[model samples]
Target: MSKKVYLVGAGPGDIELLTLKGMKLLNRADVVLYDALVNPEIFQFCKDDVIKVNVGKRKDHHLKKQEEINELIVEYAQKHETVVRLKGGTPFVFGRGYEEVRFIVKAGFEPVVVSGVSSTTSVLESFMIPSIDREFSDAYRTITGHDMKSFSEIVTQYHSRENLVIMMGIHNLKQIVFTLLEKGYPSTLPIAILSKGTCKDAQQVVSTLGEIEQKDSLFFEQMKQLTPAIIFVGQTLNATQELIAK
Candidate 1:
């Protein structure tokens, strides 16, 4: 029998949000490589004898480099009958799951993919912010806030009916707001920071571009404590507010 590698999505912080397929694979996996953001509760699904490995990466701390992770997958597959690479959110959405798949295939093994709930939509939903409310927005754009130069180049203009869902951007919140403002976004435009969303200690802060700008530097410093957050901006949030008010 040939050994195989599986790329699984662990969903957001909610262990229950894990897909049935992903859970099944974890149970049968001989070895599991999971990320840091994946809910710890999901491990309960793994077999008692399963070998678990942590391969998560943070802003400045990485347990293993991407190259090392790819190599690990191949190494495990050769030694185990079933190997699972459990990632936070969907595998394809900035999780770098595809990169692992490429390496696995090149190493002469087929990879199986299991789809999981994505944080891009679920995290916003957890805060009652509709990514696209037909009444307020027609489309939503999800982008990375890690690179300022590329971000500034890509987002040339702001659209009133387009909501923005920024990932990995909590560190650049102030700069992102100012950049949007410089690009002609309204000073009063609604914005939200969803921190540790879907987790037991999840928190949310609702403010505006102008309000944030008016706050002291200490404000941003405090915001930094809420790492691994999502930045949501658009009029759709206003609609949600009105709905709650009524």
Candidate 2:
């Protein structure tokens, strides 16, 4: 029998953040495939006979190309093994989780998705910032700091908006700050970046858009030492309504 595949969201870096359904499938996986951003504790759930493969990509480290990863998933399932691809954050949210599903279905195997707490939404909650505050922000949106740069002009276009969340943005922190400034984002707009979100060693750097360069040596310096983060921008941070107080 051709085995079925599971494309699961492992959440950020905290195993506790994983959904019960995700945990259930992970525990029974015949093969465990994961990323550099996944919580290490996930390994404890798998059996000794299970095959564990690392598809993690670190800063500056070469990544397994997307096509290669897609092929690998199909190859394993073809051999009659239950393949589980555990990803950090949601698979499709900058995790390329959707592409994996497309490949699986094309290969004639059905793919099951198990959702977990998404860091895109969870990070702002951790920092006491609201994704959308009806009283303060007109709307809340998510955009990729790096992908936005690919278009150059399009990224500059997005910077004009006030309410936004950026996932996997810290590595390009300096560039994102410069682009938004040129596009008229207020110099004093409140911005927050949470590193290693939902994890025990999480750290956050909150400052005005302009001060990111002026104070790079202090708060931003420590943030660089951490991993797996998200950036949030808008007036919502300064909203009178206390998100945490609720």
Candidate 3:
């Protein structure tokens, strides 16, 4: 029998957001490797005897290295008829699903990708924020806040009509805010941090580049607890305010 692995997206920390196909695969999976951002409640779909492994990674902690995760997927595929690699959000959207797929294919196993709803858009929508609105924004840019150099290179300047959706940015919120300021982004530009999006305890912190830059270290420290958050900035945020006023 040919070995196969399913790369499934568990969605943005919401159990109901999981795709039907993903849920079906989880129900039949003999082994599952899930990420940190994935809701633990999602595992309820799996069989009672399923083998579940936590291969999640946080800011400074990793349960399993990428290499180990890759090898484990292949190893499990050899013994289990159904092995599922459950990830947060879509497999390819910053989930490192492509790398895992490549490794699995090299090991002679077939890899199947099941796309999930990405937090990039859904998180903003959850807070009544539109990523792209004709009245405010014409386009949106999604980027990672993990690397300062890459971030600076991409966000050369700010456009009022363009919205920015930043992932994994809570850690470097201070620096990110300063970078935007240095890059000619207006200090008064509206920005919002949507944390633990789609989860029950989800919260939103709204501010501006200047205000966030001036926030005390204590504020940033507290923000560290809110991982997997998105830093959204653009004029489109005003639209939400307008709707609320009416």
Candidate 4:
């Protein structure tokens, strides 16, 4: 009998933020596969017998491809009793959790989703930044800053006065800025990029699309090899100043 694949969200940097249901699965999972950004403390709950694998896809490098990972999910589940695919932030948020789910399902496996706290909330919460508020934003969206097509898709989908959250966007910051600006998101639309979100030494750069590079020298250095971060755009950026001071 084939076991199930559980895609669990490890939450934003903090192990305590993980959901009880997700943590329970981790403890019992036969194969506990995780990404690089996940907090190592979460693994303390798992038994010594559990198998842990690290396969984070960084810029121009990947331990395994989508097809390979899909195969691993099916392969592991068939042998092991349970398989847990742990990822930082929401598994679905730029983490390719959906792709894995699709692949495993196609391979005759049912993937269960356990939602946990995502960086869209915790990262901003750490800095006391709110993603959405009644007076500040009508709505908010989470998007990726990966490729041109992804960035274009975001601009096409979101073009109103709403809060926008971008994940894994450091690499394409310039393109993101140019695209959003061209789409009429306002030159001074107020943007905040949270680096190493929800972790120690976390840095928050608050600037507009045009001023992001100019405002910070580290921005260029960070663009080399930055960790997961959340980018906020719109009035939501301005509204967070008061809360951050508290």
Which candidate number would show the highest lDDT if scored against the true structure? 3
Distance (Å) between predicted and true CA of 236, model 1? 0.4
Per-model TM-score on C-alpha atoms: 0.97, 0.87, 0.98, 0.87
Q: Tens-digit lDDT track for model 3 on 38-131?
A: 8999989999999999999988999999999999999999888999999999999987899999999999988999999998888888889999
Worst 10 residues of 3 by lDDT: 1-10
- What is the lDDT of every predicted structure here? 0.91, 0.77, 0.91, 0.79
Tell how far residue 111 is off in model 3, in angstroms: 0.5
**How much RMSD separates candidate 2 from the native structure?**
2.9
RMSD of each: 1.1, 2.9, 0.9, 2.6
- Number of colliding residue pairs in model 2: 1
How would you encode candidate 4's per-residue C-alpha lDDT over 98-143 as one tens digit per residue? 9898888888888899987888778888887777777687777877
Ranking by lDDT: 3, 1, 4, 2
Better of 3 and 4 by TM-score: 3
Clash statistics: count for each candidate: 0, 1, 0, 0
Better of 1 and 2 by lDDT: 1
Error of 4 at 9 (Å): 1.3
Clash pairs (backbone) in predicted model 4 = none
lDDT of 1 at 37: 91
